[model samples]
Target: MSTFGTLYRVTTYGESHCASVGAIIDGCPPGLELSAADIQTQLSRRRPGQSNLTTPRDEKDLVQLQSGVEQGVTLGTPIGLLVRNEDQRPKDYTETDLYPRPSHADYTYLEKYGVKASSGGGRSSARETIGRVAAGAIAETYLKRAYGIEIVAFVSSVGKIHLPSSIAPPSAVPVNGADDNDDVEDSLSPEFRKLLATISRAEVDKYTTRCPHPETSERMTKRIIRAKDAQDSIGGTVTCVIRNVPAGLGEPVFDKFEAKLGHAMLSIPATKAFEIGSGFRGTEVPGSKHNDAFVRKADGRLGTATNWSGGVQGGITNGEDIYFRVGFKSPATISQAQETAQYDGTPGSLAARGRHDPCVVPRAVPIVEAMAALVVMDELLIQNARKTAAALLPAITTLPPTMVLPKGKQ
Candidate 1:
């Protein structure tokens, strides 16, 4: 249950306040360059104590590569990684012995497993994502070198504050209420589309909120600081874009591209919602307005004039840039006292202690990117294997034009 993917499998381990947390990445293609530093970039971004808005846990989160590499290149074996938990304070969580934190996994984990970690949120902690992020970085590196894929994620909203690109679809008219003359823009603004195409991780990292928009990032900072001051927490959404992905990468039916992506994103701690492309906004627009008309690219490949499908059609990729958003709930572990029940169902008040982010979206950006990379990387390998196997068969030149794929249909 700790692992993900089929061919490109990843198994994460350890818990919060444990000796270490990391992952073993299996099925990475041989000969790719890899190192602890390659994984550290994203880990550092996910680490705590980055600013006043984040927890003061003060973990270096330094990753140690344990196996699957010689010199500087991977050997196509399972890559082992570890990050020591240097700043654990188990005593701070002693109160949990009598009470389970509200809105947290404590009660549910115990109910399912019959026992729970003695300190912090245990496996539910964001610290568990360190392995995920590290594994994603490796996947990302391979994806970049092999296919020029680019994955970038940034904070789109913090509490009530949302970037202009992520605002509600005021332009959307109700499907039944709209006439032919009714104005509708079910897709993101052209400017936002441009930003999604061009925004870089460096620009996202420039702000503490991990939001590339300057004015909105400043307001998000203030909002998170307010929660930190109140000893409470806030929630928000992260938007990620994957560019330069080839077509025919996703599996249909069960393992659809967006479905796998949703599985990956929702697996992260504190995540509450996941939406791809137009998401809930598409419901308001009629099919007439929502359909993405096919267009011929300059290079003669088929392309979508409007990517309302978020680069996917029929649950498979359509060669356009894929994008999605993930929503994270407010952290359950807060310093403020809350009226809750004890382990025995007795009513009591609990004021939780220990370092926790007031808003987790900023740090969640890298995790989102990592998961996205894993999904794409895994799907890519699957698709490649299918193609390689299919290539061994004789070409069916007698098939009808409609049944057979046209030459160079990408």
Candidate 2:
């Protein structure tokens, strides 16, 4: 059951301290440009030792494209990718054979599997997510090219240190600045101008940390420093928004859109909660105040005045920005010692013995975005295939006159 999605199936493999870890993506359409470089961009973001706020595990997360792609395009085959584990320290967890870390899956893994890889959390390790992120980047590229869909995620909060409302807009999109030297600078397309304006309003590049706001980034950095020094960890929420998603992307009944997204989010290490539009807050509001009002746009497109449904209705996308939030628990391996039990059920005091993060929300931002992109792209492909099949039905039943003449000539 490691595989996910009915259309775009993704199967992840390998362990945290194993020789390598990777994913195999099936159902990718042929002719889409793909390369290892595309996947690396995302792996670099989730790679450990990237910053002071995250774990200090220094691995170069270099990806190897194994199959499915030829030259630069997909061959309609399963795409295989691998990321080697260069800086593995399995010895750190060798003691786990006796002392199982509290609040970790060590005890449960042993009980369920009867046998488990003791070093690192094995399959349960966050390292396994590298494959997921890599595969997701490829899916994202296809989604963007085919549908102009975009996904962006950012750290909204870290523990009690929250960003100001004015700093980060809830659903701001990222944009690249225009170059003054370009001859086409003055003749910018309307789309480019709109993108620039959005970027300017979002202020995404104002901070070196890629945070949407400068003051918020500074405050978040300070909070991470404080938490590290106190030998504790902090957790927070990540918000993701997918724009321009087409309608009728998800299947009804068992395979709902939100359910697929939930499966992906919960797969991330430390992720504890998932919520869609309105979510828990909707319960507090009356039905009238919570419901979205449908309206027609100037372009004759259907739109919603309010997005309480989170751009999804009847378990399918409704051609709106799909927005959701995921909650991550603090890193379990903190420096502070706590009372716990050994594998033998004896009393013991345990202090985490490896390099770990004071906060994981910042790094998790990209992971969340990657998962959302993967799901949306899969759904897009499914919808497109269905449409193509329906359009070909009449043509398949009868040959065209042009085809008959050509056959006789041949």
Candidate 3:
């Protein structure tokens, strides 16, 4: 389960309190330029102690490239990466011995594996994502170089404090006591579409909340600070967009593009929900109103007048920007006292002691971008392999015009 992707495989390792955490990336194309600094940029963004809103645990999160490169160029071999855990405080997790840590993975991991790490959340910790980010950076570099692909993610909401672009009209009165939002607002509002088209990482990082909008980012900062002051936690959503993707990527049925994306996003620690395009809102809108209308793009390729489908049609990329949102639950390792059952089924009060984030969406932005890159990269390679293999075969001129693509049309 540690590994992901088919051709561009990535396997991550290490625990929260371990000496080091990293990933091994296999199947990267040879001769691509790479360096530790490139990977470090994203790692730094994801590291703890970025601001008052996040955990106070200070980690440099410095990256070291161990293999698969020579003279700053990838060798097309398995790329090994490592980031040492310098500021680990295993003693802070002493309460975990008595309690499973409410809403945490401590219980489930032990139940499934029959044993769990003695300190921290082990593989369930966000530290495990170090390798993913590293591998994704490589995939991103390749994607950008090969297709000018651009991926950007940012905080869209913190608890109830949502960006104006993300706000939707209130739900209509329940019909027959059924809950539905038939008064659905346009998921791809003109303002939101413009933001997706132009927002950059630099603009997002300017504010600690990473919301981009000045007013909403300030409110989100206050919201996170309030939770930290109360020794509680909050949940939020992250939205990501990928642009300049060519049409016709993704497998049908089993490995649909969005399905793989959901798998990757939900795999991150604290993630609770995943939605693409119109998401849940689409359910309420009539099919005629929700459908994306085809239009001719300036590049002579087909596009949608309305992107309610979020750039994907029939589970594949459609040459439009692919966008989605990921929801992260409140962090479970808060320093709050709670009455709960212990591992042995005894009643006890646990006041957990550990430096943890009050809200995770700001730091989760890069993880979202990284996972998106991996899915796109893997699907791109698969599609490319199929195209390459099909090119070698004799032309099928006997097929009906409706059944086969016309020559030079592709």
Candidate 4:
């Protein structure tokens, strides 16, 4: 579905080669400060042509806020945002009219709709996600203000060039006297854990690759450049951490928090897999090693000695940092010649043309962060409504099962 989220719903419109692309965000709470600059920051990160490894197409991706805000404050109405397509090259895709690009959405779209957009695969294009990132930034901004939630995502790997073992831990390991959460986790100092684990956008944006570690980011960049030189693409992983989320944010069974998170991440263009907490690695360890022991925190709340659960258990937030990884497949469009059949099932040789990312993780970072924010924001509203209802349960107990108290009393 083009629309996402329950309470904080978003409906995206337009296509990659269309005149403009954007999203309409509904259910946004009012009275928060918002502006075009706030959404542009993330859109710039998700925009094309920012680095040597990504597409050469340079798009300003300047967002225009059409409605739902007045005097820089949201009005609790549907927010409409748009970004014009100033650099789209529909002619660059004239060749694909003959045969569907391998591993792309061309064939499936044509099969499903009996016709498909002739340029950039239409809705299949990464360009379509521009609206998502914009809407996500809004959700993230609200989350930060309302709950002090911080969502940071970075490229963890590119092709075979994984970050060194010294750096590739699933959790954010702040260093020095900074936010290294390692030591504070096992003790009663949950306050210290919060202090040490905070990561700012400045740190994440320091490198073009978005990997905070200088040495590892260089390797990832080189790997992407190498793939571009070979006319092939490489796949990689993106890790996102959401911190300062209080407990009880997801529903049981169907709307489990992590399940919704996975749904959001997989909806991205090239994302192939999603994992949270220890993910598959926990299977390699014994039960004793994998389990997170509980402790009484300095704030008089139950805290985990370790966060192997990645801040969530039973699909709900546990007040720990929620960290997860998303695996993106190599870009399907490349310049290398390949043997393929046309729509008529006849043999053909094709060399795909046009700009595409040699590695998508760097650009995917913000997109992942955006999706994560949307999920959490929706769950937060649901949980808040639950709290509102639970608070009134006692007063309504004497009424009939289907009845509700009068407005003034409630």
TM-scores for all predictions:
0.96, 0.85, 0.95, 0.90
On a 0 to 1 TM-score scale, where does candidate 1 land against the true structure?
A: 0.96
lDDT of 3 by residue, 48-116 (tens): 999998888889999999999999999999999999999999998888888899988999999999998
Any runs in candidate 2 off by more than 4 Å, and if so which? Answer: 165-211, 392-410
Q: Candidate 3: which pairs clash?
A: none
Estimate the lDDT of model 3: 0.87
Q: State residue 405's C-alpha deviation in candidate 2, in Å.
A: 35
Consecutive 10-residue window with the lowest summed lDDT within model 3? 168-177
Best by lDDT: 1
Error of 2 at 253 (Å): 2.2
Rank candidates, TM-score, best first. Answer: 1, 3, 4, 2
Residue 324, candidate 4: how far off, in angstroms? 0.3
lDDT of 4: 0.85
| lDDT at 125, model 1 | 86
The lDDT of each candidate is 0.89, 0.76, 0.87, 0.85
Candidate 2 CA-lDDT value = 0.76
What is candidate 2's TM-score against the reference?
0.85
User: Which pairs of residues clash in candidate 1, taking residues 3 or more apart in a chain or in different chains?
Assistant: none
The clash number for model 4 is: 2
Per-residue alpha-carbon lDDT of model 4 for 1-410, expressed as tens digits?
A: 79999999999988779999999999999998999988999999999989787899989999999999999999999999999999989999988789899999999999999999988879989998999999999998899988898998877777776655444644323233444322222221354234228656678789888877788888888888888999999998887889889998888898889999999999999999998887775544456666888999999978998887888998889998888889999999999999998989899998988889988888999999999999999999888887788676555557785697454433
Give lDDT tens digits, candidate 1, residues 1-410.
Answer: 89999999999999899999999999999999988789999999999999888999999999999999999999998899999999989999999999989999889999999999999888988888999999999999999999999999988888988777444222221234435555575466767778778989999999999988889999999999999999999999898899999998888899999999999999999999998888887766778888899989999988988878889889899899898889999998999999999999999999999888999999999999999999999999999898777777776789887797744431
